[model samples]
Structures are given as C-alpha cells and as structure tokens.
Target: MRIVVVGGGYAGVLAANRLAKAVEAEITVVNPRPDFVERVRLHQQVAGTAVAAGPLGSMLRAGIATRVAAAHKVGDGTVTLDDGSTLDFDYALLAVGSTVEPMAGTVPIGSWEGAQRARAALAALPAGAVVAVVGGGATGVETAAEVAAARPDLRVRIVGSPVAATFTGRARRLVRDGLARVGVEVTDDEVVAVDGGDVALASGTGFAADLVLWAIVSGVPELAAASGLDVDADGRVLVDEFLRSTSDERVFAIGDCAGVPGTRFACQSATDQAGHAASALAAMIAGRGPKPYSVRYLARCVTLGRRAAVAQFTHLDDTPRDTALSGRTAAVLKELATRGAKFGARAGFGA
Candidate 1:
C-alpha cells in the first residue's frame, strides 16, 4: 500500500512513524520545510532563549520518504505539490496544521516563520521600548512573560480580554501572579486595530507599541477546502469518530486541521489523534474492525518565562479543575511534559 501524509507537524510526524510500525505501507510525508518545529516553544524562540526547530531527518523513522514541498492540493488518491509534482497514494492523511496571518504592521508568533520574524524584530528594538503582545490565551501569556524575562530593559504588556481565560479561577490567579513575578503587565482590554505604532482598543483607548506580536492563530490551512473536501466553517477538514474524512473513506484528517470535537490545538491531542488514526487504519488494512477514536484530558501546562509555570488539571472532557500546581514544581512538570511530547513524536511511545 502507498500512503501519503501531508504536513509534517506533530500530528503528521507521529502518524507516519506509528503507521510505519503498524503497517507495511510505503509512507511519504509532505511538508513545506525540511525541519520539524516544536511549536509549543515558539514563544521562547521569539524571546531568543531556545531553538524550536531541528532537522526533520533525525525525527522520523527510517524508510519513510519525505517531500520538502508544500501540498498545493489533495485529490482522490493523489497529492499535488507546489513544485508541480504529484504522488499517488492508496490512502492520504491530511495533517496540515493551523496558520496565522496577523494584520498589517504586526508580527505573528504562532508559526515557525512568524516566530523568526518576531525574533528579528524584537532583537532590533531599543531598550525601554514598548513590546505589546495582543492575545490573552496561552500563547499570548507565554510570549509576554518570556519577552519580559529575557529583556528586562524592554517594557512588555499583554492585552486581551481576561488573560488566561481558559484556566480555572485559581489557576488563572496563579498564572497572573507568575506573569507579575516575571515583570509582565497584564491588561484586560480587547484589541480592535493595530496601526503603524499604535494599538487601538475596543473601549476607545490606545497605546503606543514599539513592537506588536500577534499570538492568536487565525485558522487551519485551506488544502481541504480548496480540494472540495468536507470542511467546517473554520476550514478544518471534517472527520468522523475514526478520524477518516467524511467525504472520502481513504483520506483521514488529524491534528489542527481535523475538525475533531472536544479536541484542542495542542501537541498532546494531536499525537493522540495520530496514534488512533494509525491504529484504525492498520486494523482496516488487516481486514479487522477498527475502534473509534477517543481522548481523555490530562493537564494543561503553561510556562511563565522559564522559572514558573501553571499546570491545570482537567476533567476527561478537558474542563479545568479547581486543583492545580504552580511554582518550580509545576515548571519542572511543564518541562518534562514538553520533553515527553518531543520524545513521543520521535520515539513513538506515548500518543
């Protein structure tokens, strides 16, 4: 069998590796870059503290072919690359991940390319310059704290509605305290527009920002939509309980691009989906019944610079619990979780 996996992010890489171990299909991974980017550490990359990407050749298992080109279109049993090349497959896994396109005059730190640009822009700024991060989610809080810790000379502020709003009340308080300790100012304001050097707020307030980093992800890639596949309103490919595309039985969608209910855009969730998809595909190829995909939430870890973190325990459905961990222990746990995610993708153990 010939299998083609599109987008070599966390989901695609894990799916390919796991599938390689389960089935005897000829697997090929198509990605725009030759390196595998650890997207969770993009904030650190922007802050100039860590490298988030490395050689992709070292991550994937042997015997899996890789095409260093963007997938322009995914058709029935075929994938067309931007370089005018085509690869026919018996099954295709669409793992193309999320993307971000910030408004004019603002740099985005969501993707690897955008993180590099943000890093260069932040590095070129003068001391005491104002760096405004527009988003209050995990990415925004992490970026704000990282920048403040890395460059104390620069003023860092995170503006959004109810910063760290996803966590429980107590966990949210701990995140705020951690951010404060790292010298990051949190503002409960909604950003309306980003001009050359001014950020207009929804309440008619404005702030001068020497550098603006957008941490919000816009949406997933348009590969499925452009190819006339079933997609949700957000352009995520629609998949059934087994992670197979609703429109095509031979095509499976996982990761950020897959419209999997109750799943968040996280590496852990992506790897879990990948593992399930691989197992199901293998079962079907072996003429056996496949199990439905299911996931259980463990914990959500957010780093406040490198010294502190908040690990919020969640219920099976991913709802936050009142109990949580903070301080150095939480930081260590967060670090271990990050390393475990990388190891899981490379070693094909945890999914």
Candidate 2:
C-alpha cells in the first residue's frame, strides 16, 4: 500500500511520520520547502530572532519519502504535483495547511516565505517608525509584543480584537498590562482596508505607519474545496470523526485545513489530530475498527515579550479558568511550549 500526504506543515509532517510506522506501506510527504517551519516562532522571526526551522530530514522518521514539490491538485487516488508529476496512492491525506487572508500592501505572517519577507521589511524600517499590527488574535498579540520588545525605538500598535477575549478576566488583565509595559498600544477596531503604509479602520479612523502587519488568522487554504472535497464555508475540508474526509473515505484531512468543529490552528491541535489520523489509518490497514478522533484543550499561552506572558488555563472545551499565570514564569512556559511543538511529533500518539 502507498499513502501520500499532501503537505509538510505541522499536521502533514506528523501524519507522514506516524503513518510510516503504522503499517508496511510506502509513505511519501510532499512539501514545497526542504525544511520544517516552526510556525509558533514566526513572531520571533519577524522580530529578527532565530527561528526553529530546520531541514525536513532532521524531523521525519527514517523510511518516509520526502518530495520537495507543491501539490497542484488531488484527484481520485492520485496527487498531481506542480511539476506535472503525479503520485498514485491507496489513500491520500490533505493537510495543505492555511495562509493569511490577503491584506493588500501589508505583511502577513501566515506562510514561511511571507514571514521571511515580513522580517526583512520590518528590519529595514527606520527607527521611530510606527508599525501597526491588525487583527488582535494570538498571532497579532505575539507579533505586536515581539515588535515592541525587539525594536524599542519603533512604535508598535495592535488593532482589532478585544484583547484576550479567550482568557479569563485576570489573564486578560495581564495581557493588557503586559502590552502596555512593552509600549504597544491596543486598539479595539476592525481594519477594513490597508493602503500603502496606511490603515483604515472600520470606524473611519485612519493611521499612517512605516509598516503594516496583518494577523487575520481566519484564512484557510481553498485547495480542498477547489478540488471538489467537501468543505465548510471557510473552505476548510470537512472531515469525519475519524479525520477521514466526509466526501471520500480514502481521503483524510487535518491541521488548519480540517473543518473539525471547535478545533483551532494551533500546533498542539495539529499534532494531536495528525496522530489520531495515523492511528485510525493503522487500524483500518490491520482490519481493526478505527477509533474516533477527539481532542481537548489544556491551556493557551500568549507571549507579551521575551520576558512577559499570560498563560490562560482552560477547561477541556477551552473555557478559561479564573486563574492564570503571568510574568516571567508564563513567558518561560510559553517559550518552552513553542520549542516543544517543533519536535512534538516524534513522541507519536503516546505523547
């Protein structure tokens, strides 16, 4: 049997590696880049810090074939590459991940190459230049904090999002205080348009800046939908409880591309989903019943800077607890979590 995984991001890589050991089958991972991108550290990259990206070979288990090519299309039991080559497989897993929503003339940290370009553009800006980050989600929060900490001379502001809406009251207070300490301004308004070095808010407010960073995380790739796979309104592939596509049983989806209810695009969720998909596939291959995929949220951490953060403890369904960790301790934990996410796939399901 042959299995083809059409992506190499957190979900794709983990699925390929875990599936390789599940059965005696040929497993191939198709990716455009040769290295694994630690997406959690992309905010650091934009702040001109070292990223956790490394060669793909370093992370994948031995015996898994790696193809450095983009998947152009997925047909019945076949994956077509950008170079016109095709790979036939008994089963295909679509984990193409996601990209940031297009905000013309702004740098978005949703893709590997886009983050690199954003880093360069940010680094080249002059001191005291104003940088506005739109979208106050996790990416926006981290990017604003990182920028403020890294370039103290520059003015950083986070626009959009109510600031820590997912956190408890105290944790939300910590986030607010941490951003203030880093000299980052928080604006609770939506960005309707971005002109060259200018941002127009939905409330008719406008601001000029040297650079604009868009953190709209609502963007998901449309590959699956375009290829006729069942998808939700946001173009995320709809999958069954076992992570198999609802439209085709031979196809599975995970990570940012999967339209699993209550699932987010976090690294932890991706790894967990990938492991579950592999386990289900292994069971099917062995003629055993596959287990249903289920996940729970433990906690969510947002770095205010290198030395400050807010770790919001949560229930299994992600409801915030009344207590939260703040200050350097939370910062350390956040940093460790980001680092661990890079290699978390190696632990497989037992982890």
Candidate 3:
C-alpha cells in the first residue's frame, strides 16, 4: 500500500517515520524543508542556545521518499503540491501544521527560520537594556526563562497572559516563581504595540525595551482549511477516534495538526498520536480492525532556567498536582523527556 503524509512537523514526521517502518509500504513526506524543525525548542533557538534541525532522514527509516513541496490541496487520496505537482495515494494523512498568528494585523511569523531570526535580533541589542516578552504561555515562559538564563544583564519583564492560555494557578504560579528566581519581572497586562524597542501597553504604559519577543502562538500550514478537510474552529483537522480524517476516511491526521482527544501539540502527544495513526492505517491496509486512539502523558515538565523546572504528574486524566518541582532535578527530567521522546519514535505501534 502507498501512503502520503503532509507536513514534516512533529505529527507528520512521527507518523511518516512510524508508518514507513511498520508496513514496508511506500511512504512519501511532503514538506518544504529537507530537515524537520524542532519547534518545541524554538525558544532556545531564538536565544541562540540550541540547534533548530532534527533527525528527518533517520526518523523516516533512512530510505523513504520525500518531496520539497507545500501541500495546497488534499482530497480522498490525492495531494496537490505547491509547485502544481500531484501525488495519488491509497491512504493519505493530512498533518500539515499551522502558520504563525498574524500579530495584531500585520505579518504572521511562520516557520523556524523566522523564529531563529527573531532570536538573532536579541544578539545585537544593548547589553543591559530591558526586554519585554509578550504573552504568558509555554513559549513565552520558556523564552523568558532562557533569556534570563542566557543574559543576566538584561532586565527582563514578562506580561502575564490575560487568559490562562498555558498553565494556571499552580502551573502559573510555578512559572511565576521560576521567572522570579531567574530575575524576570511579571506583569498582568499585554503589550499593544511594539515601536522599535519601546512596548506600549493597552493602559498607555510604555516599557523601555531594547528587545521585544512574541511567544503566544502555534502556527500550522492551514492545510486543513485549504484541502477542504473538516476542521475545528481552532483550525485543527478534525479526525475520528482512530485519527482518520472525518470528511475523508482515506485520509488520516495526527499530531498538533490533528484534533485528537487529550492530544496536544507537544512532542509527547505527537509521538503518542503517531502510533495511533500508524496502527489504524496498518489495520486498514491489512484488512483488520482499526484501533481507537487515546493519549495521557506520564510527566509534564517546564523549565525555568538551566537549573530549575516544575514536574506535573498526571494519572490517566491530564490533571496536574498542586505543587511543582524546581531546580536541577526538574530540569533533568525535562531534558530527559525531550530526548527520550525523540528516540521513542522508533517504537511505533503495529501498522
């Protein structure tokens, strides 16, 4: 059987990698870049602390075919590439991820290339200038923490989210404590405009910032809407319990791009959802019963800096514990989990 996967992101890459190994099937990955962007660590990239590329060739079993194309159209069993080329397949997976959110109304920063460049801006700024990070989600928290860790001289001020977008209460407090430990100042209001390095708040408060960073977005390629797939209001591709595209059974969707229950855009969720997509697809190809998908992460960690972090443990249900961990111990767990999940791609479900 032949299968085509769109987007080389966390979901697409893991699904393609697992499926290629499971069925010995002809697999094709369609993405613009040759290597996958480790988007989860993009904040570190912006801080110039980590590399941006990931193991694309090895993840795909080292031999699966890949095309440098952005999917503009997807159907029952066909994908139309950006270059006007088309690939027909027996089964298709629409994992095309999101694009950056349009900031206010201007250009939406898409791709790690832009993210890396955003971080590069920090390098040339005045050494002891104040830095303002807008948004209070994971990306914002991580970015703030990394900047504080990397540049102790810069006065860092973070505006807490108006909405509880990432974590709340304990989680939010954990982040606050972590930031405080790293010498970052937290504010409750949002920045309305960025003029040069000066950030204007909605209440007419202006922050003298040498660097401004936006950290409250998860962008995909908009393939779900463009391909005519049924998507949720949040712009995720709607899928069934087994990760099959709701509108087209021949198509499967996974990862952050796919709207699966309890499956988030995190690397952990992407890895777990990949097994689900692979199993169901393999079952269909082999004329067996497809299995439904469910996800629950073992431990969740958020890093405060190089030394401290918080570990939120869950039990089947994704409920976090009241207290959190900080310092080197939590940092080690977070680091291990990220690295471990990368290797866990090799252990996929039966196709």
Model 2 segments more than 4 A misplaced: 347-351
The local distance difference test score of model 1 is 0.90
Highest lDDT against the true fold, candidate: 1
| Leading candidate by TM-score | 1
Ranking by TM-score: 1, 2, 3
Clashing pairs in 2: none
The TM-score of candidate 3 is 0.91
The total number of steric clashes, by the backbone 3 Å criterion, in model 2 comes to: 0
**Which one wins by TM-score: 2 or 3?**
2
Evaluate model 2: give its lDDT: 0.84
| Tens digit per residue, CA lDDT, model 1, 1-351 | 999999887888888898899899899999999999999999999999999999887889999999999999988789999999899999999989898878777899999989999999999999999999998999999999999999999999999797898887889999999999988888999988988899999889999999999988879988999988999999988898899999999999988899988988888788888888988898999999999988778988899988889999998889888889999899899999888888888776544
Report the lDDT of model 2 for residue 245: 90
Candidate 3 overall lDDT versus native: 0.73
Rank by lDDT (best first): 1, 2, 3
Name the lDDT value of residue 88 in candidate 3. Answer: 92
Tens digits of lDDT, candidate 3, 61-164:
66678998778888867888889989999898876665566354222223587676666677876778887777776667777888889888888878754522
Better of 2 and 3 by lDDT: 2
lDDT of 3 at 181: 88
Candidate 1 wrong stretches, greater than 4 Å: none
Model 2 lDDT tens row, 1-351 = 999998887788888888877789998999899998888888888898667478987788888898999888786988888899999999999878778775898888867787888899989989989999887778888899998999999999999757656666888888888999999998988888887877888889889988898777766766787779888988988899899999989999988889999878788778878888988998999999998877778888899888989998888777778878999999898888876666666544422
